[model samples]
Target: MAPQGVAIIGGGIFVKEEHLPAVLACPQLSLKAIWSRSIKSAQETAKLIPGDASTSVDLYSSDSGEGKSFDDVLKRPDITGLIMALPITEQPAYIEKALAAGKHVLAEKPIAKDVETAKQLIAKAQKIAAETKATLSIAENFRFVQGYSYGAEQVKQLGKVTGFVVRISWSMQTDNKYLNTAWRAKPEYQGGMLLDAGVHFTSALRKLLGPENAVDSVIAQTSLIQSYLPPVDSINAILKTKSNVVGSFIFSVGTTLSAFDFLIACENGSVQAEGSRVVTTRGAGQNATKEEKTFEKSNGVKEEVSAWAESMASGTPNPQQAPEMALADLELLEGMLTSGDKDGARQKLELQHHV
Candidate 1:
């Protein structure tokens, strides 16, 4: 299959530092262009690419090619797909435009603010698949992370996935001096911390447990405005699925330590991942066994790019963390916030699941 030419929109810090390098490392994909919309962003990212690159007005074609806007980037004749890393509020519009342009898309998580918008995006994605056979995927990199990928194997050998737990937390060292004016702190931009960071836990939940599974019930507590930022500081929830699968999750960004993303509780065994280290236990109390699996820290962005490139090239979508998974997670997140135990009343999972 021919290499799919990808264009990355938004030259944000995450995309430039994390994703751009990943796209460059993927042998199957070639970055055709980029659209940052700022001279500073365009120029800053221009230095990261290795070929004969140049800066333009927030939009640039790789290898010293012509410049274009976000719309132009989607409409370009040579491009095959778009890699979106824009703010959550800005995501749907671009995804819609890209789909309308008949291009396959890979976007960041939390498809939209509410369940209905997410459903709209999902419908659009389905229409794209039905009409053009192109599809949309989310960059839930945690599922593709080296540690979690290997941990799943241990869970399989231990037995069936009966239950699970996840604690995903990270510390931000941003200067508060400019935070008030920053778009990140605003709900409109970042979609709150859970949508931004906790999303990893939700997506990983689908991966660690299983996709096509919806939350039958959930109990949650979210602390946001009371924190340093104008948004919620962190969220804690206990989720139960229709399959009677139960799990606890804590997704937080305003914290001290910057690690620990997962724990998978299986029937006969349990597995936990602290960064790259994974420890697995097997059997009952009398004949219990445990082993730790060590994996190297890989270039995550590269792996994601390779996977996306393969999907676009082969016209086949990988099952893990597919479109349905993203939607399920979004529904879970919405239910989480709405299901708060603040009023001492059990909240129902009101969002509908397509799966």
Candidate 2:
């Protein structure tokens, strides 16, 4: 099928840092245009899109101020969906506009800084989608990454999966440019590193395992590691899914190593994927053996963009009922944090729209 014509609606670190590279690299999706308030960003986005005058994508300004902006791009005949990677707070208005314009959408995580906004956006997106029949996807790219994909696939292959475990710990150097302490450290934009990273883990777990999962009423602790940015440093939690499965989450911005891996233990077998490959151990006791499932590094951004294209053309979603990933993950983060509060209470998460 032909690739969907996509327009990205943000500039700055996320667009330049992650989205730009991915969009440039993706084969199934074409960077038709970009909307950043800055002309410099507009030029940068235009340069990255793959085309000449015949194929050039119109770059738009995301600023929506006194200057030219994406508001004009949304009215164009060629654009279909808007890929949003804007700050957590600045998302809802754009999402609503995109949906109203009969355009599809794919947004970054923590759809909104808070759940109420998430609900509003999701409900609005759904309403527009039902009426307009367009696609609305979340840019939850971590799920497309090989390591997480393999780990989740193993859980499916192994019957009667009982539990899931994941550890996403990375000690980002203070000077890590990607993680600007100024923007990310600020709670409103970053929502802490977990909101940024941990959401990926929770989204992965729910999709790979089951959203019916919750931290057992019995055991689980949510521990905050640092305060670099309000609620952006780190957190750890042990959870149990309704399937009677137990999963542990160890995520920290203060990790000594750049460790981000998920291990799922099942009744028949267990799988572990680190850095690149997903390995499985079969049988029980010392007799058990280990085998790994390896796949080429996924062109995740490309695949994700392509998926959005196909969904728009096909009018069907792959992981049906999977709520907007970024929004749901943020809700899960909220629940985890609230449960992790000093009272030591059980948190309820309902994000598993489809298991």
Record all residue pairs in model 1 with backbone atoms less than 3 Å apart, i.e. clashing.
Answer: 36-58, 37-58, 224-232, 224-233
- Residue 99, model 2: lDDT of 79
Query: Considering every candidate listed, which one attains the maximal TM-score?
Result: 2
Please write out the lDDT profile of model 2 over residues 1-355, one tens digit for every residue.
6666778887766676667676666666666777876667777766654456325756566453543576787777677778887766777788888878888888776667777778887888788878877666777766677676667667777777777667777776667775673557565643466676667677766666644443333233454455554554666666766676766777777667577677778888887876368788888899998997777776366567656666677778756324555656676667766766644476776654544
lDDT of 1 by residue, 8-122 (tens): 8877777877888887777677677777756567668767877664342135533334545566677677788888887777788878778878888888776677778878888
C-alpha lDDT score of every prediction, in listed order? 0.69, 0.67
Clashing pairs in 2: 35-60, 35-62, 36-62, 109-326, 110-326, 192-231, 192-232, 193-232, 213-241, 215-240
